[model samples]
Target chain A: MVPSPVMLKPALDAIGKAIDQRFDKLLAVPDDSRARLYEAMRHAVIGGGKRMRPLLVVAACDLFHVERDRALRVALAIECIHCYSLIHDDLPCMDDDDMRRGKPTVHKAFDEATAVLAGDCLHDIAFEILADPATHEDPFARLELVTELAVQSGPAGMAGGQMMDLVAGDVTYDLAGITRLQQLKTGALIQWCLEAGAIMGRASEGQRKALRAYARDLGLAFQIADDLLDVEGTSAKTGKAVQKDAAAGKATFVSLLGLERARAQANALIDQAIGHLSGHGPEADLLRAIARFAVERDN
Target chain B: MVPSPVMLKPALDAIGKAIDQRFDKLLAVPDDSRARLYEAMRHAVIGGGKRMRPLLVVAACDLFHVERDRALRVALAIECIHCYSLIHDDLPCMDDDDMRRGKPTVHKAFDEATAVLAGDCLHDIAFEILADPATHEDPFARLELVTELAVQSGPAGMAGGQMMDLVAGDVTYDLAGITRLQQLKTGALIQWCLEAGAIMGRASEGQRKALRAYARDLGLAFQIADDLLDVEGTSAKTGKAVQKDAAAGKATFVSLLGLERARAQANALIDQAIGHLSGHGPEADLLRAIARFAVERDN
Candidate 1:
C-alpha cells in the first residue's frame, strides 16, 4: 500500500538529515593542504536536493533487516557517485552550467581546477566506501558490491551514458535509442540504489528480482519526469534552468511522445514500479511513495 | 643481486610487448557511436611510458609464481590508473601540457571534453579489471585489491596527490611537507603495484611487509629520480618537457636538497629498497634490477 502522505515526508526528511551528517563526517579531511579538496567535496554534497537515492537505500534496507549503519555507508557511496557526476557535468567543458540547487556550481564556487579534482575525489571515495569492510562483513559480498558498483558506474553504466548524452547532437537516435541512453546514464545508478538495500541485506533471489524490475521502470520514469521538468519545471522549483533540452533541440521522452503522452507514460511506469513491491508489506511503503513521487515531484 | 644491464633489457622488452598486446586486446571497444570515447581512451593509453608500473606489478607477481596471464591483467589495470592520471594532468585546467610521450595530449588530440570522459573511463575500467573474477579466483583477494587500489588512487591517494600538486605553488612546504605530498601523490599507487603481487600470491605476512617497505623506498627513489630528470635530463630523452620544476619554482627533491644531495638520497633509498628484498631468491632478481632502474633512468 502507498505510504501515508505525512509518514513518507518525515522519513524522507530524516534520511536527508542523516545523509548530510554522515557526509560531513566522511568529508572531514585533515587540516593539511589537502583540506581545500575536502572543502570542495563537502561544499558539493552538503545541503543538497532531495536525497532520493539515500531514501531508496534506507527503505530497501528496512525490508531486509540490515543494520542501518551498513546501509547508510552504501547510501553515502552511491550518493558520492551521483554528486560526482553532477560536479563533472557542470564543468565548463561539459554542461557549462553556472548554478545547481540554486547555488554556484563547484567550478564557480571554487575554481575549474578545484572542481575537477573534487569530482575525481568524490568518484574515488565511492569505490573506497564499497570496498571497505564497513559496508559488509562478508568479503565476497564486498567484492560483489565493488565490482557491480564499478561496472554500473563505469563505462558500461553512467560514464557510457554520459558519452551518449554528450554525443547526442552528433548522431540521431530513435526513441528506443534514447531510452537505452537514459537507462544506462541514469537508470543504471538508480537500479544500483534499488539493489543497495538488497545487497546490504542479502535478500532472497525473488526479492532481488522484483526490486530490479521495480528499479528499471522507476528509473525510466524518473528520467521521463526529469524531461518533463526540463520542459515544464520552473527554475525556482527545480533549482535549475528549465526548457534547456528543447532549446538545445535535444530529443527527450517529452519531445518524442509529446507532453500529454509523456505524462501518461510516466504514470504507467509508476504503477508498474509500485506493483513490483507487492510482495513486501508496510516496510516497502516508503518505496511505493518514492515511486509515486518520482513522477509527481515538481523537482 | 642487482640485475645486470644485459639481463634487465630483455625482461623489460618482454614486459613492454606483453603490455602492448594486452592493452590493445582490452581496449577493443565496440564499433558503436560511443567508440569515439573508447578511441580517446585507447589513444591515451596505447603507446607510452617506460611501463615501469607494469614492470613493478609483474616482478612482484613473479615473486609468488602467480600466473603470467593474471599478472599481466593486474599490470594492465594499474597502468590504466597511471595513464588516466597523465591524461587528466595534461588537461588545460591541470598541468595544461600539450604533449605526452612526445605526442599531442588527449585533450589536444581530441578535445577537452573527450579527454575528460576518456580519462574517467580509463579510471573506471581499472577498477573493473580488478573487480573481475578473472583478476583473481579469491573474492577476498579481489576485495582487498579493489579496496587497496581505490584507497591508493582516491582523494587519499593519487587524486589527493594531484590536488596537492595543483596547490603546491600556494603552500610553502619544506622538505618534510614536500615529502609527504609526493608520498601521497605518486608514492601510494607505486606502493599498490608492489602489493599487487603479494595480493595475487596471497604471500605470507613477512613477505607483504618486506615488499611494502621495498615499494615505499623504491617509490621515493623513483620520484627523486624524476626530480633529477627535471633538473638534469633533456626533453629529447624524457619524451616530455624538463626543467619544469625550477621554472615553476616548485619545491622538489632537487630544489630542496640540490642535485648532488638528491642523487645521494635516491641512491640511499635504492639501497634500502634492495635490502628489503634480500629474502627473495632468483625470482626476485628482476625486482632488484627494476628498483635500480627506478632511480637510475634518465626519464
Candidate 2:
C-alpha cells in the first residue's frame, strides 16, 4: 500500500465539506408545493457517509490542477448517482432495508412511492448538473460526462449488476463470477468518477489510462473492504446492517475466498492501485491515501 | 376543435410506424445476460398507445424541415421518458396497476425489481441519446435538452406530480390545484416534446413560443380527455383499468366539472390549442388535426 501522508485526512474532509455545501445549495427547493419531494431528497443526500467517490473525483482532478468549481460540480453529480442507488436499493421492493446510515430509509421516513420518485428524481438531477455549461465550457467534455454516466448507470452498468444481485438466489456463482458482479455493480460508477475527472481536467491519454487502472483496483479493493466490514463491523459503526451477505447465504469476497485470503487480496489490490498512480507527483498523495483507506477503515 | 384533415390519419399512422420500428432497433440488447431488463423495456414501449408524443415531435420538427434522423432521435428520447414514467407509475408501490396496453404491466410481466431497473435504464438511455453528437451537431441544443428534461422530470414536474397523487389522501385540491397537478404530471413532458423539436430545428423565438402555447393548451385538453375516458371508456378499449380515478375518489376534470361541461371544456381547450398554430400554414395541418384528436378520441 502507498504511504499515507498526514494531510490526507484533511484533504478528504475538505472534499466532503465541498460536496455537502454544493448539494445543500442544489437540493434547496423553495417551491412549497414540491417542498415534500425536496425534503425527501435532502434527507437522502445532505448527510451521508465517507463520500469516497467525491474524494476520488477531487483528488483525480487535483492531479491535473483542474478548476475547482467544475470538479466540484462533477463530484456533486456523481454523488447524486451514488445516493440514488442507495435509496432505490433500500426500497421495500428491493432490499427492503429499514435502516440506512442508522436512520430510517427514505421509504421508511416517507413512503414507498415517494422513495421511488425521490430516487428517480435524483438520478435525473445528476445528469442535469453534468450537462450544464457551468460544469465545463467544452461541449465535448459535458457530453462525455453525460454519455459516460448514462452508460455506467444504465442496464449495461449499475442496473444490470443490480439485477444479478436480485437473482443471486436463483443462480450460483464462483469467485470469478462474483468478481465480475462486484465490478459491474460498484466498479463501473467508481471508474466513471475518475474518468469524469480526467475529462474535466483534459488529462493526457497516458494519464487517463493510469487513473482508470487505479480506479479499477481501488474499486475491487473497496468492495472487499465492504465485505470485511459486513463480516466484522458493528451496525452502529457502519450505520448499516452487518453480516447481511452471510445471513442471506450470499456469495461475497469473504465467503468465496475465505476471510483471511479476502483481506490479503484487498491489501494486494491496494498496493497495485497505488503502484498505478506512481507516475503522478505528490498531488496524487490523497489518492494513494484513499487506496489504503479503502481497505483500512473501520466502517 | 380543428377539423380533422383527410391526411391527418395517415400522417399519425406514419409517425406511429416510425416510432415502432425505431424502438425495436434501439431496444435490441444483444447481451443475453441483461435480456430481462431489455424485455421489460420493449414490453412497456412498443405496441403501445397512439404515440402522441412522437407525433408532436415530428410535427414540430417538420415545421423547420429538420433532418429526419435527428428528429427521430429526439422523438425516441422523449418517448423513453414517457414509457419510463408509465412503467414506474404501474409499479405495485405506485398505481399498482396489473394491466397496461391490453397486457400485463412491466411489473406483472417481469417482476417489480426488473420493472424498476428497466424504467431506470430507459431513463438513462434517453439522456444517452441526447448527449450523443448524432442528436445535434450543436452541443448547446443537446445541453438545453438535458437541462430542460431534468427540470421537467424532477420535483417541479413529473415526480412532483406523482408525489401529489400519492399524498392525495392527505389533502384536497380545488380545480386550479388539480390543474396544476395534471400540468406538472403530464403537461410538462408534452410541452418539452414541442420545445425539444424547436431546439432541434433551431426555431425562432416566436416559433418556439407558438409551439409552446399550442402544446400547453393541447396538453390540458389531452388530460381532460383522459379523465373523461376513465369515466366513460371500457377497460378493454383503453387497454387499462378505467374509472380508477373515480373509484379512488380522486378529483379529476370530470369529477370537478360534470361530464358534459368537461367535454365542452376539452373542446374549448382544443380550439384554443389549434388557435396557437394559426400563424403557421398548411405545414401545421397535422398539429391542428392532433388537437382535435386529443379530445375526440375514444381511448
Q: Point to the candidate with the largest lDDT.
A: 2
DockQ metric for all predictions: 0.75, 0.76
Over the true interface, candidate 2 deviates by an RMSD, in Å, of: 1.2
How does each model score on TM-score? 0.97, 0.97
Cα lDDT, model 1, residue B154:
84
Give interface RMSD, per candidate: 1.2, 1.2
- Per-candidate total of colliding backbone pairs: 0, 0
RMSD of 1: 1.6
Candidate 1 overall Cα lDDT vs. reference? 0.87
What would the per-residue lDDT of candidate 2 be over residues A1-299, giving only the tens digit for each residue? 35664556787778878888988898887554667788899889887778888888988888888888888999999889998999999987788888987789999998888889999999999998998889998988998999999999988889888887877877787888788888889999999989998999999999999999999999999999999999999999999888878888889999899899999999999999999998987788888988998999988
Query: Model 1 off-target regions past 4 Å?
Result: A4-6
Model 2: per-residue Cα lDDT over B1-299, one tens digit each: 34565566787788778888988998896564567778889999988778889889888998989899898899999889999999999988889999998899999999988888989998999999988889899988998988898888877788888888777777687899888888889899999999998999899999899999999999999999999999889988899999888888888999899999999999999888888898888888888888888888887
